[model samples]
Target: MKPFKACSCRDPETKKLLGKQCPNISKKGHGGWYARYEAPKSADGKRRQPRIGPFDTERECKAELARVLGTAAQPKAHDERKTTFGEYLERRYAWRRSEAETGEGLKKSTLDAEREAIDLYGKPGLGHIKVVDLTDEHFRELYAAMRKLNRPDEKDDRSEILRRLKEARATRDGRRLHSRPISEGRIRRVHAVLHGALTDAVKLSKIRPDNPTDGVWRSKGGKRKQGRAKPLLWTSERVEAWEKTGTVPAKVMVWTSEQTGAFLDFAEATEERLYPAFHLDAYYGPRRGELVGAEEKDLSLERKRLHILQAQSDDELDDTKTEAGYRQIPLDDESVRVLRAWHKQKLRERLQWGETYRDAGRVFCYEDGSALKAEYLSSRFRILLDRYANIRAKAAEGWPADRIARKFRTTEAAVAAALQRPLPPIRFHDLRHGAATMLLAAGVPIKFVSEILGHASVAFTMDVYAVVADEMAEDATRRIAAFIPRQNRLSAVGASTVPSGG
Candidate 1:
């Protein structure tokens, strides 16, 4: 490859490139220099010769040539530079697959989530941009666009949604009139996936000099402004708002102690088959995966201990999500009693199944002793909540208890014993939040709560439940004030009226 001058100077009649053959080729301003070279082999093992540019002087062309040559010389660097972000993600790279698939890396679920994020937001927004040319601004723009992205309605078909999006793009006002906007938290997760991929590219392949994502703040004002949503207690005002609008204030909402008790009472009265599981979840806050993954040997009713050594994701049982998740949790007396009763019931079930029982040995299982899926547990919880909610609503309307139970396929006795107060809707995972809140409210040490919940750090546990901690602080002050005998003490607002006994 070499750098040389060329021109458009051509024969008047022929109208073809003259190169050095033109009459005006010797003129100072006749032509510019060009850097010409054969590019490195592509991923398919093919190389192509190319002309890059025409410069006023040979020096500029030579400089360009040097840079191109240098990049091409580095192993795989030229290919990466030519590769778009979308192409890189789609390629069968070693770093992209799960450990199970390749004997080394991310879990299949985690990888699937990453690919989904990339396809949904990353590919549409910046996938066409070359990995080598990616800048912080590109990522910032993508995140900004994602923050404004609206969630499609359940009834909105894909093609209709696409048409609306296309129309929005063509309109003067680009706002998407859809359902609620996608949460900033979810966008941040998408950011995390892209950022991780870029980081891996830089470290493992040297595809880019540095990760552009590193320069982009997760949100406009940083993490403090994009704070995590703490689990808010379903206070009366929030509950009232939810009942009227069918909307909860925050993503994470916890039931109060009274509400938790009401739910447990309802579940027990209904003779819910999974009452023991619900009790354990509400009391200990094990993740849904952990709850469904619990083996029969993991529970020690006599010792009041439940070991969370593994967790289920879909139907696959594996190690817990994190190292801290493998810790043993102390069970309360009530939880122990519930499990003991459940164990006896399971014994009777085993006898009934006899030789044909699936014998999954799970703490919670189907009637045939097959393992219960995490999703099934969540679905069942929702059904229970719906029935409980409906029955309670009818009871408030002066309907007979037996009639209400019959309508919802629950027991007449259960309906009769149901608490009049409404049980606010919450995700099954919120039971975990409620457990943490109850522990914090009951004055359990934050460290203990962290351990019980299998949080990686006490600091994180404190940060998540900081609101609960603040309330606890206020309660402490009130209790201390009431405990102290301060009749002659100075008032809080002003000095004491009575003279001090000097």
Candidate 2:
């Protein structure tokens, strides 16, 4: 390492020499101190003198020179291995965010999800582990820690409910009032994020060539598993239990054909502006974001065709979730009629709002013509379901259907039909599931359903809705059996010919 030296210049005010015989000082530029050193040789076998900086004083320059030389003296493997997992994750997030902003990277929604996973699971669990030291075991431990981290405990204070109550009293803003345990799906997401970051690290040569997260176990052995739970259809028994206990089975639930029709009848009869959107989801299986992101120009009501070009991702409108998501769907006569009615309704609302209306060109919008938010749509759908349930309960108690219909501003027929079958509690996304199930039940080809649903492949569709496929198989067997005759006419014809028996 080079020794410290001061610049050889006289102080302007004092008119005196700044230093005496400073050998390491450079007379170039502004006569500031600098350090000269030898860098590692290339494959051709030649040395080069690398210069440091125009530091204020020789002491500062010398300190920097020492650090540079010390780093060079270490093995090449250790030179690029200084960053920890936490630090690399932050850098990776920044890079990904920049890519998303420039429109050449991951979608904003994807980046946000990655950021969340890093903050919630990555940083808290494996932040301190150095990139060089990261191993499959580290990721395994991280999964275990995340699983145990936010588990609800009996002794924990349920302060969120109290906070929500206070907020309700002070202001009528409704937010979630409680927390739930971190799901296996979320943990798997974190694992995916970590795996991606470390894979990049390997490519950048910041860590070992092999990725540590490649085959890490997400759960303990022997039946403990990690992945998204398959969606469960709400049966009659489940609906009854839900009515009594106010609890629904499975995070993702699908309604039967009758229940779906009931919901649609209620929405349409009540003149819900979003009825068209919900109807499209049930019949065509477009994602919630896609339905909200739809625009007037993308629809061809006369031709009975609708184009899906984009989807809402948080506050930004972005490309579809996957390349396959950008597709054209053939609309049935009913879908076209509903869409045309909705278009006319939107025009009326726009005229009422006049110059104050914000025409963002979205098919679904608020009364003010502003774009509809996905979360708002979901929340409103839940409210409508609750109202539907109440109306059904009243109808069960012998309340006059016409009176109930008048009270709710819907038709008496709609009320009667909605009460005919028990409504299954389902989320907004479940409408997509119901659509797929209905199509499969009707014997639509799985490939066609995959395309309509914008799934990457038919195998994926079959995997997700395996239960539906099983039921379809049984139906196919029964239909085949119905075509076969127990008595053979061919045998009787052959028996009449005596030569045939010989």
Candidate 3:
């Protein structure tokens, strides 16, 4: 390692840096002193020469070089100084992927989201900084910068995204990437991932002496923060408003019992192959990943149970997100009947296809026995909703049966027979929410509902479905009032009704 003097002067013709060739390099204030040292070998065994510098004085540069040389005995200490945050993040994700093969790491869906957090936010903001250079102030500034950003949109053009962020940062006025500002909750989650990574750097890898994020305050102030939005049911009023405005009442919405039944009935009437999967979701509340990844062997008709052993994320099979997610859900008689019929249909199709069939042992699949994609559930659900909405509109308009059939390009009988019950729009995941709401409405214990939905805990389930719980409580109050034999119920307790001592 050696300390050297360098200047920012560049060659006029070549447009290259003139390091030691500058005429004024010997002058005291003409150039800055720099330190050059060989870094530890990379994973591929390649040596890297990292230059540290631009110190105003030669003494300072030599001191930095001496410090760097003293740490040569410990390669990790050198790494801590040279490794950028982005580099470490990439390594961590790679490690996680390797560990996942042993069934003890994050699923693809989780890793993808985390990678986005790192790339979209982390890289642009703090990625270039060395791990050792990170501080509470750095993180605080990062949080402030994140709060100023608009929500990212995959569909937005790259130039548009750049312009959006730049304008948002410069003038605090710009077209949004989506409908609203990036939520504080999202920032908090980003902070959490970063904090975890830094903590690992300090404790697990021993790359850093301490985590800089430890001293960083996550939020600005106050005890209040936006929690997860509870699912709201699609009541008649809400449905009307949605039809008029094309917006949901909440981020998460559930269907009323009538709406849920209408959707399922319409699906079955149309001979949708995934009807059984939809039924399972509506009644049992398994996630979309779980529904598609379900194996035929995991179902037990005699035992009336379905085991959630794994899930498909990004079209790849992986373990469930949590231990609670890997559970055995009891099936109702109706579910069993639906599964039996579905099994028979699948068998018939398999026999027809013969050697061409692709049997992956999935309980729900295409006619050729190919596995269903996780996203198909959501997209197909949307298609079904639109079809159902169109049919209902035609029926409501009192169009002649033949005209309505011709409009839909289907038989007049099929068009006329379509159920007209309103199927208010809800996400496929909302089918899971509707299932939980139905369970709560049916007076099933909250604990049982939690287990059915594969929630981490009853409290979490209750917290998420608190709206449904409140509605159920109100209904219970009304039912109890009606059930009790009250003779001329008083609007308020009379003074005479109170005890004499009171």
Candidate 4:
């Protein structure tokens, strides 16, 4: 080919481009596939050293060029194997994606996420680095890079950054791109992916003694500042206001959230064809979807118990949140009243529209007496928020449905928005927390609260319930005040009479 230079022209299609030199490559962005060149770009009259790549960053560009030119500069620690991080990732990605044709663990959502992560952080930050070279230090670097690459602006999150992270982590890009810090959950995922890949590399004799990620990280929740870990909740006054008017969406949402305990409870409580949905959730706490998908007869009124047999989730009507989510709960008085009212109401609806009601026979139904969908309930919750804009205005507050949607989780948001704005606002899920705190204040056991929240371990419940437990300590002094000994009995408790061990 004619000597390549700033102005020298070649068929854009014919000239092979490497890394940043590709016309299609984004300057600060990433795009479709391009291969590494086997030789450096020719520098016209200058007798020169190798030109790594057209990349802006010399480190990554030069390293990639070393891989293309010869085996001489391969990984110093594992040079005999002759591999680089980027090359390994490319290969692994191809293999995992190829599994889709064979119908393996291929999922559209996952693939889409991986593609987005690559586009933002690129394969270099994730898959291309050497396995043996990876260290906890490297993970910190990767996480920092990832953080730099995206904005935590609520809008950016809505744009799918988290989804992409999920996909990227599942695949080889499992390493953190920036050490700027990430959630423990995100870091854990990266460690898992790294360990898996490195373990395989070791088994295949591609590396030495161990998977470097081993014991480097212990899994935990996200450390990133995504507001807070706790869910939000509304206040009682706001809830009562909405209940009185039956017009404001915020008030309606507030009532449902507090009354139900969680969003799932609201969904259950409001289920039409599946009447008495809340009976199951309020007492046992199945998800809104689980309640929505339940049959009219799923719960046994005569048995005075509800069965959490299965759950309809974000995916399918598969297994519930876990085995813990599938248990029987005896109805409390309130649960019984609500369930009976709903059942009786549903029976009247059925009489009014027999054939229509028989269609799904879902206990949770719409005005038409047809089974209700989770999305419909979610929408109704929103409608309630909009209808009460005046009430929200009067309270110097407003709903945040759009804001909630960006989080990829919203029932919690609705419940939170329903709360009247306090001195410092409270999140909807905070209602559940408030309930737990109240229970703790009331001397209820941690194990009981944990079971209500559907936590698998009591220790986990206690750890999360720590703050509420402290509230109980405050009451300790108050409770002990009643037992303070009488003044007459205190005369014998003089300091001189008490033996001093010291």
lDDT comparing candidate 3 with the true structure:
0.78
Candidates in descending lDDT order: 3, 1, 2, 4
Clashes of 3: 0
- For candidate 2, the per-residue lDDT at 51 reads 66
Tally clashes: model 1: 0
lDDT of 3 by residue, 239-285 (tens): 88887888877888887666677778777866676888898899878
Candidate 3 off by > 4 Å? 1-75, 119-121, 135-189, 215-224, 396-398, 409-419, 469-502
Scanning candidate 4 in windows of ten residues, the lowest lDDT window is 249-258
Which candidate's TM-score is highest? 1
Give the number of the best model, judged by lDDT: 3
Shift in Å, residue 329, candidate 4? 1.9
Q: After superposition, how far is residue 41 of candidate 3 from its true place, in Å?
A: 18
Off by over 4 Å in 1: 1-34, 37-50, 53-75, 79-81, 91-93, 96-104, 123-130, 133-181, 210-214, 217-225, 236-247, 348-356, 469-502
Cα TM-score per model: 0.74, 0.69, 0.72, 0.46
lDDT string for model 1 (473-502, tens) is: 555566578889987655643564545783
Error in Å for residue 276 of model 2 = 0.7
Query: For residues 1-502, what per-residue lDDT tens digits would candidate 2 score against the true structure?
Result: 4643455576677777766344434554445666777766654777656666668776788776765664454334344556788898999899888887788998888888898777656765677777766778777755655454335542353443322222322323543222455566676777889999988876764355568788774454435674555777666567889878989888878776667888888877766668888899999989989988998899899888889999999987999999999999999999988888888898899899999999988988999999999998898788778778778878878899888888777777667667777786788888898899878877789999999999999999888887954654554566578778858777887788767546
Candidate 2 vs candidate 3, TM-score winner: 3
